[model samples]
Structures are given as structure tokens and as C-alpha cells.
Target: MSTPPPALATPLSGPRFQQTSADLYAQMRRTHGPVAPVLLDADVPAWLVLGYREVQYVVSNPEIFGRDSRRWNAWDRVPPDWPLLPLLAYQPTMMFAEGAEHRRRAAALDEALGAVDQFELGARAQQVADRLVDAFAGRGEADLITEYADGIPLPVVARMIGVPDAETADLVSDVYRTHAAGEGANEAYARVRDKVRRMVESKRRAPGPDVTSRLLAHPAALADEEITEDLLHLMNAGQLPTAYWIGNTLRLMLTDDRFAMTLAGGRRSVGQALNEVLWEDTPTQNFPGRFAVHDLRLGGRQIRQGDLLILGLAAANQDPLVRPVPQASTGNQAYLSFSHGEHRCPYAAQEIAKVIAEAAIEVLLDRLPDVGLAVPAGTLAWRPSPLFRGLAALPVRFTPAW
Candidate 1:
């Protein structure tokens, strides 16, 4: 087993990570070089890859840095109640699978997501956006994070996976709780998995034209347990980031004068804002990641076999070596927000997220032409979690319309 992280390693969690993570990354780079030694909850040590090239290397060479969490050497030190257990625990899903098994699961998922009708999905997103806006349109004031951003993506995703409309409201709440990483996070994760399991069972009895149903009928012959676990991953992966993408992009458009001028029916600026968020404030800031298969050197650090390396995605995006001028990211798609390599988010899934996020913003701007932040921008608080970056609340006000 690999040795524990050095005494001087930085703990990955705390209030310092909530808002100013870029600064934290800069400090780590200054202190520990590209691959900095870091600690997770309970002082479990790991490497945080803060360099753009280093992160790219880790993900690209999956043979050397595997995705299997079962290879972790710190499991001996981790207690049963660890908060990140739900994220790191090995499961029968593609996220943990390697070799032939990974390919099989990824192929099935790609086919399923690829078959989704983008035009139809966009219309559904618009419909969902309209319904959500209608709820607060008359009030003239609402917390966009809670009322709109959080409400848009999951319902569309749940329905796409054949989850019934009646059950979606509760599923949304459970999903948010799971990502909150606070009290009841583990319990919320369990409930979300249970719901996905039930959905898989229902799909067995009566299949539909949805992603889950497609996976069920795929020639890959994935077992029900596999499908259930993967669907859980898919739902969590697809919904949370997309919701935050919408929220972050909206926040940028509302606060930044560069984007504020374009709020009046400017599609180009909306797209620019979406891309900018992926660079500056990605939804998934860091990910519990690739395990070192054996002793090797990365970014000048001596990695031992079974060592854990957390992908510092946000840090990599902000790496001065690659992004010397942040403004140059206006139209660049080179950001690592969707990750890289064999285990990166599926292209179709990325496209689906883009469709949903774009529709959500365009429809909102259409409905509330003068939407603006109701509270001072400085008063806005981000949720306290290192693994994810999102606003706790985005209070906003606009002219009421019936």
C-alpha cells in the first residue's frame, strides 16, 4: 500500500475552498508544484493535479492511472461514515469499470444517449423552462437558484430516463440534498439510487423510448444491477452539472457588464457566458479520480502504487500556462470541464446538457426581459463543498407579467 500523504499536505475541504478555489489552487501550485499533496475528509491524503498538462496526462494514460476506486490504499483508514464514500465506492457502473467491461458499459450508454432526439429534448426543455418561469412570473421576485435553475434540468433528465412525472418532484429534492454534501447527504444518495432501481424495475415491465429503456434493450446485455447503478450515475452526472451550468451562466449574464448588455435577446452572448462558466466556475470543480496502478512519477511527484489522485479540473482550466489570458476563452472549447480520456462525459450527453442549458436561459430571457439580481452580488454565497461549486441562492427580481 502507498504511504499516507505528507504532513504538510493541504486539506481539500474548508470555507477557503467555497468561493476562492482559484486562489487556493494558485497557493498550492506555489507550494507543492503541479501535483500537490492534499488531504480529503478525515485527513485522508491524495494528490491534487493542478497543472493543465499533468491533469491531461493522468486522464489520457488510464493504463497507468486506472479508474477503479477499489485500488485505493486508504480504504484501511476510511471509516464507514465517511461523507465521500458514496462517490468513491466501487460499483457495477462504467465510472468504476475498466478494460472490456468499461467499453461495454460506455458503448451502451453512448448508443442510448445518442439516440435521444435533440430537437425534441430542446422543446421539452423550453416547456419545462416556461412552466418554471410561470410559477414566479407573477411574483416578480424569486431565488433563481431554488425556483428555476434547480427545477429545470432534473425533470427533463428524469423523464428522459422514463421516471414518471408524479415522482420527479421528490427526486429533485433528493438529488439536491445528495449534492449538498451536508446533513443527510448519504441518506439522500441512497434514496436517489433506490428511486433509480425502482425505475429500472418498472422499465423491465414496460419499456419506453428513454435512455434507461434503451440501455435495458441494448445488445451489450448489461445486467439489471449494472443498468440501475449506471443510471444513478447518469442522473446525478447529467442533472447537477447542467443545472449549475445554467445557474452560473445566468449569474455571469446578470452581474458582468460585458454580458449584461447582451441580455436583451443576444444569443451570441448567452453562448459565450455558458462557455465562460465552464472555464472560470465549472460546476464540478474537482473529481475523486484516477488511482495509480503502480509506482511512477507525475509532475515530479513520486506516486506509489494504489495512490489516489484527485483531478483538479477547475485548477487545470485556470492554469496560467494554458490560460495566460482568461479573456481569450471566449470561444475556445479546450477547457477540461467535461473532463478527458476514455471516461470523460459522452459527447451526446454534453450536447444534451448544452441543449437544456441554452433553452433554459433563452426562455428565461424571453419571459423576463429585465431580470436582474435582487440582492447585492457580494451578498451571494456559494455552497460549501470542494467537490462541487454552485451558488447557495441566486435571488433576483424582474417586472411581473401574467
Candidate 2:
């Protein structure tokens, strides 16, 4: 009585996510209207929800459009070397779990993250940003992605996780493979997980004032594996997107004369600039997928059970239904940059990422007022992947302050 799963057409994610530009998103919305059929991988079909209302609906009704991918029919047919397995594979953490398990796991994260002092967290961000700028302050040219943006999150997150700075620095190489989709990805994935395992073991042996220690002490009393998975979720969830978000904002601040003038003239705050960037070019363009639970009609499309549904947040943010906001940090949290619904990112309220980004850019520009792109804007190369939207490098030249 039910319709069979849809056949593959073209990948909805993958290289197209690299097309996070406003024009591309507009095209998707215009062509697909709200819901459009696109393959998740080459042969993996899924519906991409581009409407703001539709994304909210799908994410809010997790009971119907669930988080568990193991329930997906395609999971059984896929081979072990599935290139996208690292992303789509089921994990026991809140990221992929359903019902009561999601609550317990999410609680551990919420509590630990809630305990962080915003002032201190912002200070730590400033310190890290300053140090990174110092490394290249003497040179007139620096690749902001490698020297600044790409360098920010891991060490700060490592400290928050109780991972030593040295180890965090070493992870610079491995994190690349973990975020990318291709060869050596599995190996890079192993190294990062093993490192997290070591961190979990270290935290268990000697409790520290970090997220790991806090999770261990929480009422949930997560096991080592659960703690590791949750941390991995945080790493996968936060690391690259946050890094790229910072980079993208900086690019806008440095390149767009109108935006540059406003922020420089004090007409707009750094937070405001960030908010505009979120609305215009959301850091995480797509929210990977939410699989359907049963045969359901949504946005005039027939989606069968276990079919993946990707929410085009970048496109959705600009959806005609979504109006512009007056302030960046105001009560209007409608933007999908932090995602929406019950599964919304806990850090949406933190403002820690904004501080890190603002501080990093301000420090670099303060020392070198003339900083700008080392190459033409069009020449900037981006890492093409469905999971993240980011520049491969942001090469900039500046007047050496030192």
C-alpha cells in the first residue's frame, strides 16, 4: 500500500553545500520551492527542506521525523566503506538518539556547558586570539584561516575538555581528516577518537574542572564511552562550523565596504555583523538530515519512511516568511544558524563563539588597520563537503605592527 523509497537523482549535500552563497540558496528555493528531491550521496536519495517553516516543523516533530538513522532502510544496504558513513552512521549520543536517552545525554552537555563562566570564557577566547595574532604580527601577510580562524577553536575547546594544549596543537593535522569527506578520513577519524578516549581515561583518573569531569559527576553518570561519544558530538558539531563561522564573518568585515564601514564607524556592533552573517551566509549551511518515520506528505512531496531530510538553514534563514531582525542578541532567536526546535544547540545563548570571533578579528585589525585579502576575492578556494561550509584558506596581507 505504501510507495517505495525514491530513486537517486543528484546529491543534495556534498559539493553543493560548498555553494553556501546567497545566490545558490536562492536558486534552490526558487527551483524546489520548499521541499526538493536531491541525493544525500550519489545513490542515497533525500528530500531537502528549504522553507523556514518546513525546517522548523520537521525538526520540532522529531517523533515523526526522527533522529535515529539506524531505522533508515538504506543503512543495511550500504557497505562498510561507505564514504559518508562517518557522518550518517548511527551513534548512541544525543545527536542520533531518540526519546529518554536523548534527554539524559543532552542534560550532561547542558549542565557542563552551563557551568562555564561567560566572562572567563570570553577572556580565554581573547587570550587565544591575541596569541595567534602575535605569531603573525611581525609578518605583513598571513593566511587568516590557518593562522587565525582555523587555529582558534580546538585549543579553547581542548582546554574546556581538559585536553592538554600540546595535544590540542598536535590535533591540528587530524582534525582536517575528521572534518573532510574522502581518503584518510577514517584514519584521521580513528586518531581523533583515540585521543578523546585518552582524555576520558585521564579525566576519570583525576577529576578536573572541565566538561569531561563535569559529565562524569553529573546525575546521568555517563560511562566513558558515552562521555567520549558526547564529546565527539561536540567536536563534530562545533569545531569546523564555529571555525568557518569566524572566518566567514571576518571575510565580510574585511571585504564588504558597507559592512566594514558600519562596524568601523560604530553604527553596528561586531555581534550585529555576526548576526547579519548568520542571516546571510550561515556557517553550517545544511543540518545534515532528519529521517522520516512513516509515509508522510510534507511541502507537497511524498517522503517514505527512513528517507533522509536535509534542512537548508542557510536558505531557510532567507526564506520569504522570515523577516529581518532589529538586533543581533535580542529575544528574536528565529535564525537557524544555531538551529531550531527541541534539538537546538545549547550554546545558542552562550555568545562565546561571537566573543571569540569578535576578539580574534578586532585584535588582528587593531594591530594592522590595513589588513586585507592577499588575492582577489574570487580566487578564494573552499573545501567542498556537505558537512561544513568554510574557506580552505583566508590569505590576508597587513602592515606589520611589530
Question: How does model 2 score by TM-score?
Answer: 0.91
What is candidate 1's local distance difference test score?
0.90
Residue 389 displacement in candidate 2 (angstroms): 1.3
Off by over 4 Å in 1: none
lDDT of each: 0.90, 0.75
TM-score of each predicted structure versus truth: 0.98, 0.91
Clashing pairs for model 1 are none
- State the local distance difference test value for candidate 2: 0.75
lDDT of 2 by residue, 1-402 (tens): 223345434364444456444566667667767887766554556677889899989999989999887767666556666567777788766888787888888877888888877677667777888888888888888998988888887777778778888888767667777667677777777788889989999899999988889989998879999999888877766567778888888787777775667543432456666677787777777776788899899998888887788878877877776654423333345688888876778763336566667666666666667777888887776787765678888898877867
- In model 2, where do residues sit more than 4 Å from their true spots? 1-8, 13-21, 76-79, 262-268, 323-332, 348-350
Give lDDT tens digits, candidate 1, residues 224-318.
Answer: 99999998998888888999999999999999999999887768788889999999989989998899998999988999889999999999998
